[model samples]
Target: GLRVLDNLPAPSLPCEQDRLRDFMGRRERGELLIQKINKLQEKLLKKMQLSVSKDGFVHFGDTVMLLNPDSKSSVKNCPGACVRLTLAINLDEISIYSFKSLEAPCGVSAVESVDPVARNTFCILSVDGAPASEPIRFGQKFSLGTTGGASDRMLYLASDHKSFIRFAKKSHLQQVFLTDELSYLTCWQAAFLDPQLRLEHEGFPVP
Candidate 1:
């Protein structure tokens, strides 16, 4: 009755087990790569010799910046899903650092900045169809919409600041983006998007 399994050679693993093992292997590899990239970025940060401010901002060199070392300033009233967000600025990109915050930090996430007075008009910027629920980052590159109807893009460098904004736009509409359109986020939403005004890019003038 017992064939000793010599004729069978070995009992090959099941297909599902093989698949699970492969998936785990890939996940481990992916995590290792992410860790390596993060370390490289850390080295780059040190080479630049950056310093953090008291309020917790890692900035300077004009082209790059980091806000809230491990991410901070929790959004108020998010109920069951509020998570901290990181504000990372690499040469050409000015984006919220959290992998998950893109959708969460949007809408009216920066509610505290709403004020009747002491308010300044900020132009919303986007790429392709993305909405501007983030800061204009003070020094972000922006160009006037051409008469032919071309939109601007962000390069996130102070040196790339546009000399002028488009003139064809009418008076009131120039500064305000309605809530209905994805073309831009409302001012209140923009404030919520940047409650701390991380884009103020201190040391640099409010251009």
Candidate 2:
């Protein structure tokens, strides 16, 4: 009735054979493994982030926004008016641009409502740069020009001594010196001040 082969029972029907059952089980396990791999791939893709290019430029994904870094001009009538540029980086691309104002004749202005001492102080604001529509105020101690009278128009800050943030003219650059280490808010202000400045000293690409 029952025949033994290789110390195991041999089934008459292929479906009833132990070898067939083992093959089927292996096929099922392979399918499950493949499904798990696909799920893991999808999860990793979702976790991926965007970043800027290594050339200090932004890809902007679909369309890129070209910014002129060497362009420097006087603030004109508004002594308090200052231009700010911000640079941001993502896992995929980098972004660079200047700030704009919502109101016409967008420029720096003194906060009259604040305090009298604060009146001399002004905010650097813009609409086009990163963290748009925010105010960038003077650091603790802002100095206009160089320490030894090297330049007059450029503004240098204590936060960054290597480069000047504000440039009034080609020959003259203003300098600003901060009283203390930069804070979160001031750091953001510094970002808007100049992307090149942030890149030179801040270490991060600029955002």
Index of the highest-TM-score prediction: 1
Q: Rate the local accuracy (lDDT) of all candidates.
A: 0.29, 0.29
Show the lowest summed lDDT stretch of 10 residues, model 1.
143-152
The C-alpha local distance difference test score for the whole of candidate 2 amounts to 0.29
- Return model 1's CA RMSD, one decimal: 16.0
Question: Candidate 1: where are CA atoms >4 Å away?
Answer: 1-13, 31-207
**Candidate 2's residue-wise lDDT over 1-207, tens digit each?**
997678676656866687778867867775445554443333222322223345553222211211223334544553554434322111111111111101111122212122112112222322234352222232211121111111112222232233465532332443223222233322322343765554454433323
Per-residue C-alpha lDDT of model 1 across residues 25-95, encoded as one tens digit per residue: 86777544555445434432332222224434212221222122222343344344325332222212213
Clashing pairs in 1: 109-192, 110-192
Predict model 1's lDDT versus the native.
0.29
Q: Output the TM-score of candidate 1.
A: 0.21
